[model samples]
Target: MENKELLKRIYLLVKPHRRRLVIAVVGMVMVAGLTAGQAYMVKPLMDRIFFDQEQALLNILPWAIVLIFLVKGLFYYLYRYMLESAGQRVIRELRKSIFQHIHTQPTSFFHKTTTGELISRIISDVTLIHVAISRALIGLLKDLVQIIALLGVVFYLDWQMALIVFILLPVAFTPIVNFAKKFRKYSVSNQQTVALISNNVHETIAGQRVVKAFGMERYEAKRFSDLSDRLYHIIARDIRLNSLQHPLMEFLGGLAIAAIIWYGGHQVLSGQSTPGTFFAFLAALMMVYEPVKNIGGMNITIQQGLAAAIRVFNLLDTKPEIKDQPGAIILPPFRKAIKFRDVSFSYNQANPTLRNINLTVVAGEVLAIVGPSGGGKTTLVNLIPRFFEVSAGKILLDDHDISEVTQTSLRDQIAIVEQQTILFNDTVKNNIAYGDLDRSEDEIVTVAKAAHAYDFIQELPEGFDTEIGEGGARLSGGQRQRISIARALLKNAPILILDEATSSLDTESEQEVQKALANLMKNRTTLVIAHRLSTIQNADRILVIQEGRIVEEGTHANLLADGNVYRELYNMQFKNSNSEPSNLTP
Candidate 1:
């Protein structure tokens, strides 16, 4: 996007606080006027007091100087405070908007993006924007005001010399523009590099056990150091570029001062101007130098801010790929079955994950889906929730099409217990009662008992209120699984999807969680993606999906007797144990 357009968007954000901004601008004008008035005082101070030997002027001069500076300082504080408060509020609102927008994205967006990158954009990039809005933009306005007010003073004192100083102002703009371009390019790279570092840190921390098991601490550290090293070089270039601007500006300011002194001295010596007039013009001209230098510094910040703004707005502009269709009605409860008619799905345009799938899961029947890896078992079930819209065809709940109904109403009737148990860094009770926040404490305990999680809950330090560490790190795999099952139980959803819930458990834990799973699946229409042939032998029917197509469907005994793909898979798990284990990878 063009910087001009980006700036307009920022204006819209600031528009809400225009009243405060106006007050700040008024404060800035006061400071600018006071600065000009201070320079103007040099005339009378020089002429009436010293040159004309007016000793009586001393009585009023000290008080006048103090009052001018006192008011200038007060206005400075007021404007800075107002601008900073406004800037912080902007940052707060932007962060909230970005956070809310991110959650609105489809699940597929998260699959392609890293968690750390999102965090970096939220924290680091927005902070750069804060710097630009509060410091740089505010400084630019104040400096511009100072320049204009000081120019007016110099012109009133002597127009010919005022014109001379004004002519050199544009000379600094070329380098400032060049530096701004370079700063923007580097700033974008800088934000990306910070995201990389954030991603690396997140991965290492989340997978610390894997790193330790592989003895990869030094390797991970080396990787982090490499990213930091890259950031170092980028920032060094930034510092080098930033450092060059002030010196170039200072040199230009020196040239302006030299011209002013030589020209104003000639005027005074030729009696075309008084010492008072020449000195007052020189003072105003000198004051212009500081604002010019400040403008140079503000350029770098605005550029960096612009770069951050690009990433932030880009995220905000992304629309969720999956959202309720206009005029879609709330889905009624699942009754007869979930029907997939000519359903197909592809993660990308080049490859189909599930092809021409036709299946019906009855409202109260347990359907077991078994297949070799990459056979689309989980993907098929996920389609029911509209996590990813089907590439072609439709899914229906009884007579109602799932696509035509609102997702909230559709998902309200379903519960899932995935292979990897997901828990939060919160109390055990809160985790169980997550979806249904209105559940009474007694109800949470009842579900806990039903999922066979009560025993462990009672044993925790704080009983039901015990804090489970990040992702339930403090709990055993079986304990976490049971807690997850308890959560599903509390939801009391009528449709259940179990994606190999016991896949990672040991024999004892598996036995415990299977009891919990049995309690969770009671009377609900269940779809089970199996990793073990033993677990789903009692399913109403077994489906063998291979290479995105259902190759076989029958009772366990019938499929085993037929000695086809289902039999082969059964033998692989029970008889031909040397074959690779079953899992849902697609």
Candidate 2:
């Protein structure tokens, strides 16, 4: 990310909260003015009471001192609160925008990214930006004010002394800048390692069950330790570099101060300068060095923040590959057919997954697709829902090109039950109702019955109210698949897809579920991607796909009579079914 573009983005986030930001800036200015006023008051008090020995001024000095402190303290508290509150509000909005963007990103986007990295960016990088704005900016402005105010006082008291002080400024500042530059490099390194450590911890915790099951707890721990050690060493190096700042500044400032005091004392004795003027100049010189040191430290923090900002901007700048086209329209209801014409697709263009596939499924027809594992059956079905775009050719619904319709409209008419059940870690009723979240309980029960899920659900301790474990691990594979079918049934879409939906079930469960499926498939354009040929032999048409093209298409009876690929698949399954007598786990 270019620095100019990055700053522009960051500035936009602040724009919504501009009123608060302006108030914060006003508060900072007020605080700096009060602090500088208090510093300026010191010299006046010393000159009147000690050097001049003015009796009346001496009598008023104590009260004046107390009043200055009182005013400074009040402004300090008020402005600090205002700046902090404004900064926090900006941070809140920034985090919300980032999270909302991530939520809307498509499934394919997540397939190529890691959850660990995304989470770290939202949690850690945004926080660094927040601190930079809230604390560092305020500190930087105050330091600038302090330097300007103190320099003005010193120059007013004695121009020659001020000039001398200015000449030494570069000498005192050079090493501090050089040292901070090194620490800035180390700071960026440390931050990256810390992010790496966070990613590792998130990954390990998410997969802890697998680690424990394989008895690899020690191995996981050692991996974490190794990553953490790198973070620790990087942090140690950064700290060492930061440590050089304080003493180096102090040494240089000290030598300059010692020289100033010696020269001033000689001038006072020789009658070239008065004790009052010399004392005031000396006091102002003492106050100048602190602000200079703070400014140096603030620069280091800003550099670290810039590094974090680059990562954040990179994420924000990324364009999602799949987005709605201009003037996209909602897909009308499916009254005729879903057609794929000369369709070919690949996640990467170099290696095609689906090639020149031409097919159509008319309204209320069952189309079963059978193929070897890598022959693109699943990929072809995925294109119907626009889970991915066809790299070449087009898919049409009712002869309307799907790409012309909005993604949500295209998906609203279709439903899918995959090989694995995808139930949320929620109550059984909610999982089924998730298909149409606004559906009434009565409606939920109707669909569950239609999927043969009501019987097993009622047998559970809490019936529909029972909390199913993550991925529905609390239930058997057959039961989970039934719940998934219940979800699809509840969707009541015009098109239904079953991708090996019954492959994991027992013979008895399959028989019961098949009855429910028969009912669900009635009057809908249905597609089944099946591994078991027996389940699909009854389909209205079986499409035997091989190497991304349909090699055979016919009814079960005709395909069997033809003695082709479908017949061979049917015979193999028939022989196995007759030979293997089943008395297995239910």
Candidate 3:
């Protein structure tokens, strides 16, 4: 993305508001013409009032000058208001577009990108762009108009003096172009550093409990200081460049004025130019320099905005890897089995996560998958909903290839409850009835009661209407898990994928959740990513996967009798406690 293309895209975005922009440009032109008119009056004031001693002209000239300023102020307000209004609307749409783009991305996108960086891009980077649109716009457009109008005044008074001024003026601004490249470089570093700071803050806050437990407050503080110091260095470089432009413009403007004074004084003495004309040229030239200074000051802001726009545009260009195929059809209800034929998957394609995996989970059967931490258990479950496309093979849901179905229809039939339960900062009822917002209160209560969550719901201050705070922070671990289970129960999907992460709970809480799990798994085809033996003890069939391959498959007792991978896992789990692995809590 070159800057030209970026600017073109931004122009397209601004096109919808062209009516307001045209009016604003009209107002700006009026203000520019009036600016030159102010310098024009200096000529009459010098020649008529003082030199000719015209008493009658004084009254009209003062009132005319006052009228010019009053009208200029009106146009100034009009243009400022219109430009900002247009800018705000464009930003609103741009921010929303960015958010929607991020949501449409595949799950793997989230795996590779952090929440903090995305937050920084949406908030910090967009704000930089906002400043450029709202502030730099006025500087660039209005200043250019002012420069042209003022140049007309100087040229009208004496083209030779105006030519000399224009020649020196370009020299003053040449350094501005030289420094622009550095401005963008520093700004990009600054935005990235801000993202690092955002990431560090998000981590510290999300893991505050761990930070306290490990007593790493000072360590985290040091890390944050490092990020802040990095931002400071980058910002300092940008500001230094900005400051350098200021003095260079002042020096050049001073040289131009000095040359004008010497030449104009000689012209007036030689009767080639009048004092009034020379003075008016001096005034117009000075006003021209003011807009030049404003432009120079905002140059860094504009360049920084362009840098931020590059990042924003790049993010927008990343189309989602997972989306509906052109001829995809809505999936029918799940009635038979989900079969994986020669299904091999890898996150990066370099190393296989699931290799030549062939399996069938029949409808209404409880299939327990037990494996080492990184043995692809979760990845296997994720493939069913098409969170990631299979690297090589296809998944068939009820004899229909899942890839051939619309993702929304395919996902509608599946309900998932994982180790880290996800709940929004909404009400208890809303969380449970997330997909079915139109569900009645009675229906919500029915699912809540089934998951053993209705009792806790009544205990809260607002009952079913209680705000759970972020990620159910206000609730106990068991309470949150039960609410999560209630949500899945409400979905009433035929297929259920449960992580069975009850190992983190107390004995009593685990029992409560286990009861909820029983209700949730009653008639659904369930896949349990089992970590403990208690979860899979009653499973119809247990699978043992190791290093992306199925090592064994049988009931719990049959696997133990085989005395292979399953038996070794049983020994390792129980060896930590007494002989009773089932009684040993997670």
Highest-lDDT candidate: 1
For candidate 2, lDDT tens digit of each residue in 1-586?
Answer: 6769877877887777777667666766666665566556666676667777789987787787788778767766766777677778877887787787776677678886677678777888787777777677667887787778778888887788888899888987787677656765776776677767777887777567799999999998898899888888887776776787778788888887888888888888998977767877776777778888887777777767767777777777677666678999989998999899999998876888888988989999989898777888888898998888899999999988988989889889998998667889899999998856789989899988877889889999999999998778789888898889888888989999998888888777776677778777888999988877767767889898878888888876787788387777767767756554221111
| Global lDDT of model 2 | 0.79
Q: After superposition, how far is residue 29 of candidate 1 from its true place, in Å?
A: 1.1
Evaluate model 1: give its TM-score: 0.94
After superposition, the stretches of candidate 2 with alpha carbons farther than 4 Å from their true spots are: 51-63, 175-196, 268-286, 425-430, 455-479, 571-574, 579-586
Q: For candidate 3, what is the TM-score?
A: 0.94
TM-scores of the models, in the given order?
A: 0.94, 0.89, 0.94
The global C-alpha lDDT for each of the candidates, from Candidate 1 onward, is 0.86, 0.79, 0.86
Which run of 10 residues does model 2 get worst, by summed lDDT?
577-586
Give candidate 3's root-mean-square deviation (CA, Å).
2.7
Q: Which stretches of candidate 1 lie above 4 Å from their native place?
A: 269-271, 576-586
C-alpha lDDT of residue 90 in model 1 = 89
| Steric clashes per prediction | 0, 0, 0
Better of 1 and 2 by TM-score: 1
> In model 3, which regions exceed 4 Å deviation?
269-271, 571-586
